[model samples]
Target: MPALRIEGYVIVSADGRLADADNVMPDELKFEGDKRFFTAALDRADLIVHGRNSQEDQPNAPKRNRMILTRKVGATAPDPDNPKAILWNPSGASFEAACAEAGVRSGTVAIIGGPRVFDMFMDRYDTFWLSQAPRVHLPDGEACFPGVPARSPQEILAAHGLKPGQPQLLDPADGVSVTPWRRVA
Candidate 1:
């Protein structure tokens, strides 16, 4: 099996939430610095896997080949709404196979997510880029990994065998920082 190198990218509230309880990505928490970092990182990936909800959130998404994970679609099918995207159900199709079907031979597979999507790739992440804005706390927000132990996002990532590296300041003014956690061997 040619294991696909998977990387996770996410920005969370200070309290480790990906979004608010209603699945609303808070506009109040938006940071231009994080937007730039996210766009640049996804631009570098060969394939982007966006969960259904997250896909709906990105209206002006970049032009890139993507595998949209959706339970509504068949095991393997082209995303009718997105010509450049493929609807993939990993239960029947392997990650490598899905990539190949999407014409992705080799490169980093970036998994952009809602909690379920993030949880699905937990054990396989090569590196997970977790960015958080300490100034923004969503009191009744959605967690990065739902139903897991109530730990900081960094702790959850660490529990999955990914060790955090020094965080890079995305915006000192906004108090947002991103840490890259590489999976342990």
Candidate 2:
């Protein structure tokens, strides 16, 4: 089998929160440039992986093959609501096995996440695309990673041995930029 390229995508507020206090991604965090970039990347992925609460609500969402991480499943099970989705429990089965059950033998695996889900793939990701809305700050909100509110997201990523690339301005007016952090070989 061809090697799987694992990558992650996330957008955070200046304070490193992924969502508001209510766990909702507010409109303030949404930028058209980031959305377009995210959609294009997901379009190229062979399989998308995320926790049960996270989803990229694109027009092609139903057609995209995805694996939803859930403790409710024993191992891997077909998603009854969506034929292209699979419910997976990592404690019960390996990621490769879950990918196999999802019919994705190879190609890129996109990790779009909630904090716990993003934490799970920290060491595994070949690259993580981090976008920041420098002007926004959601205090007492959901962090992009578990260490946030204590440690910055970059600090946690660097601790995992991933180095950031040059930041690309996604929306200059909105002060939004994206940086690709690659794991050291």
Candidate 3:
């Protein structure tokens, strides 16, 4: 079976709440360590999977071969100027199956999110490249990964036969960090 990776950057409260009220990305409010790691993950991904809302949230969302899961058949492509994407309607076996059809059986397929998409595909992911931002407060926005019960990054890695690699400090002045992990199983 091909490995499916879920990669995202999120800001959460010290206790692990995903959002506030305004629905903005927590990037600006991230701890230096978490911010660094998030950038590294983005650098490593070969593909990005996202919902419509996520696409809208990103500043200069990359123009890669993306797999967008959506219900609106007539919805326009988020970035018509970039390469066209393979659309997957919400149905059938799994989005994984759709991805396979789209030729994502190997290499990294990053599931970027808007929460609902993450919940739908969490169990099928082989590894999650998450940036656990240091405790930051968001005045208004949703959680980075909402509805996911509290599971330390360590716990999730252990359950999936993975290990956390050393985390790098991107910029001390900026207070950002980056961590990497690999599946040993």
Q: Per-residue CA lDDT of candidate 1, range 28-92, in tens?
A: 66788888888888778888997878852344464888998877755779888879899988787
Off by over 4 Å in 1: 1-3, 56-62
TM-score of each: 0.91, 0.98, 0.65
Candidate lDDT scores, in order, read 0.83, 0.94, 0.57
User: Model 1, residue 158: displacement in angstroms?
Assistant: 0.9
Residue 100 lDDT in candidate 2: 93
Tens-digit lDDT string for candidate 2 (43-72): 999999999888987897887999999999
Better of 2 and 3 by TM-score: 2
Task: Locate the minimum summed-lDDT window of 10 residues in model 3.
Answer: 73-82
Q: What is the lDDT of candidate 1?
A: 0.83
Candidate 3 to native Cα RMSD, angstroms:
4.5
